[model samples]
Target: MISIAAFYIVVSVLAYVTYAIDKQAAIKQRRRVSEKSLHLLGLLGGWPGGLFAQQRLRHKTQKTTFQAIFWLTVAVNVACLLSLTLYPYGG
Candidate 1:
């Protein structure tokens, strides 16, 4: 349990940093992080950080398709967490 928590924490922080970097890149008119990568991060349990970054940085919050996918990833991540908690051994 502790390990899982730590994994999420680390990944979340990384995801948040990725968003910030991508945002900065956008401001500079440079190459930005790919949407697929961002979605992958969220799928890997970083959705919370992704959400925070989206709101706090005011980035990627306006695209309807992106928001839809982001929310879906969040739901899937939450469902996975719940399943793990209820059946740690994969009953």
Candidate 2:
């Protein structure tokens, strides 16, 4: 089994990569990071990074739907992380 630390590290890397891609897309005005990819990244615990990219790159911040979905994803991921930490293994 992968350790929690490893899992978070992977998530952070994914977040950074996705953020970079999204930023590039914005520079080219292409919107490369689709709604699907945004949702997927958020579900994977990368919403914070995604949100930062959105602000930093001035991308995808105006759509109400995107904001709603993104925040929901963040909440879900936070819930999952809290549960995982609060629950003991092999209980």
Candidate 3:
């Protein structure tokens, strides 16, 4: 449980920072972080922070396609997390 919590915490922080960087890049018209990478981060247990960053930074909230995919990734991550907790391997 501790390990799982720690993993989420670390990944969430990474996701939040990545979103911030991506937002700044967009404003500056610089190279942007790919949508796939953002979604991958969320799928890897960072959706909470990614969601927070979206509202907090007002980033990535305008695209319906991205929103749809992001929510799908969130659902998938939650399902995986529940499975790991409820039916831990080899138990």
What are the lDDT scores of the predictions, listed in order? 0.94, 0.78, 0.96
| Ten-residue stretch with the least lDDT total in model 3 | 82-91
Candidates ranked by TM-score, best first?
3, 1, 2
Off by over 4 Å in 3: none
Cα error, candidate 3, residue 44 (Å)? 0.3
Candidate 2 Cα lDDT to native: 0.78
Candidate 2 structure quality by residue, lDDT tens digits, 2-80: 9876776677668767878877877888858677887888788777667777787677788899889989999999898
Arranged by lDDT with the best first, the candidates are: 3, 1, 2
Better of 1 and 2 by TM-score: 1
Q: Give the CA lDDT, 0 to 100, for residue 63 in model 3.
A: 92
Question: Lowest summed-lDDT stretch of 10 residues in model 1?
Answer: 1-10
Error of 2 at 19 (Å): 3.5
Between candidates 1 and 3, name the one with more favorable lDDT: 3
lDDT (tens digit, per residue) of candidate 3 on 1-91 = 5699999999999999999999999999999999999999999999999999999999999999999999999999999999999989836
Candidate 1 lDDT, 1-91, residue by residue in tens: 5688898988899999999999999999999999999999999998888999999999999999999999998899889989999999999
Candidate 2 backbone collisions, by pair: none
Number of clashing pairs per prediction, in order: 0, 0, 0
Lowest summed lDDT over 10 consecutive residues: which window, candidate 2? 7-16
Query: In model 1, which runs have C-alpha deviations exceeding 4 angstroms?
Result: none
